[model samples]
Target: MVNEISNPAAVVDEETFSVRRTIRIAASVDKVWRAVAEPEHVSRWFGLVALDGAGVGATGTMTFPDYGVIPLRVEAFDEPNLISYRWGNDDAADARPDVLDPEKSTVFTFTLEPVDGGTQLTVVESGFERTSAPLENLESHRTGWNEELDKLVALVEGEA
Candidate 1:
């Protein structure tokens, strides 16, 4: 098994305090999209994901081993291209998918584009300034994306 780590270019926008990373995956857009958009595939690489629906307005919970369960709601969904979700801003123990509070949430978007022999996946996690610990959250997620995306690439490419 190849343990390739994806060095995502994480940038913290000074104006908005958002974190963004762009990575290239050695997989088709459809395959990458499935790994990102579908709850079943997501759980394999990202975390334990459970979604209520497939399109926008869908709700779900993603429980990370260290971060616990975070409330999430789908904000945008474009098949094989884009999928965005708003998750709880703070690491509160009582976070629940049914209790959505915009004041306590940040939005993360995944955009995929077909490239030569693979897909270009860009992730932008915005609204960090709205969270309780802006800088900490930004740094943590920056590192988290790098590790998780690396796992994603390994999983997808290994299957191919």
Candidate 2:
């Protein structure tokens, strides 16, 4: 059964300009990993996600209903433990690989660890200061992570 969390809060780091959130999921590490790493599973909770490849060095796009399509490239993939991506800083209407700029991208990581009964999931998104509006972007992502992760938890727990 899924143990539901009351409130999942995301912490924002001003010095590093990063957002971090942690939550315990009532699922196995591999289950949580598939939800976050796999494109098909990700689209169910996060957004309309499409990835070119599965392993590291893969490129993809996640199109949010409100935020539109954000170009992303897989930076790290460590099986069911960790998966990370660097996404474009600007929110464009369409996926634009031609104008993809790494310098203006932000890195977000999903890490899963086996806990006593389930898995401990941690998400960290950094490099917000590189965006056009640092503070605005930080605040936006801070809220975004909390809401998005809540959906993740709900989906994983079969509550959604």
Candidate 3:
């Protein structure tokens, strides 16, 4: 039997300055929602998330052990279906501001849909053109979404 999760690698669109990836997880939308929207669950698969508050307009940081803390904000949320976060994506910067810089931030939105047996999750990270190195950051985030979302699939599916 072939053992694989139906997840396509992330793609970087130069024209749009964005990275997009979609994956199917053997877990319900509710389960997947928690994994992506909750900071604790997100930290398990992605960066170490620390939000000052909850829901839209909340501001905080996601601390990656290797990459350090980056300013982040909850840009949008819609129950268990959608959640969008804007975070600093300036890969070439030597220092990061304590607050999210709208001009230099990229927003990554997670949209969840119910499927026959699980959930279809798609994440699109955009606004890379405003970052320091658009091309490099686009590719970096493209690779990042693949790795991070795969970890998320494992975490959510394992629990289900």
Each model's TM-score?
0.89, 0.91, 0.94
Question: Compared with the true structure, what per-residue lDDT tens digits does model 1 show for residues 1-160?
Answer: 3325445567777577788888887778998999999999999999888888889999878888876777788999999899999988476554554566788689999999998868899999888787777888888888877788878888988886
lDDT of 2 by residue, 106-154 (tens): 9999999999878899999998877777788888898988998888888
How do the residues 1-160 of candidate 3 rate in per-residue lDDT, one tens digit apiece?
1116567899999999999998888888998999999999999999999998889998888998888889999999998999999998586545475867888889999999999878899999999999888899898888888888888887787777
Ranking by lDDT: 3, 2, 1
| Leading candidate by lDDT | 3
> What C-alpha lDDT do the candidate models reach, one value each?
0.83, 0.84, 0.88
Q: Give me the displacement of residue 152 in model 2, in angstroms.
A: 0.6
Residue pair clashes in candidate 3: none
Q: For each candidate, C-alpha RMSD in Å?
A: 2.4, 2.4, 1.9
Poorly placed runs, candidate 3 (over 4 Å): 1-3
Question: Which residue ranges in model 1 land beyond 4 Å of their true spot?
Answer: 1-7, 92-98
Top model by TM-score, which number?
A: 3
RMSD of 2: 2.4
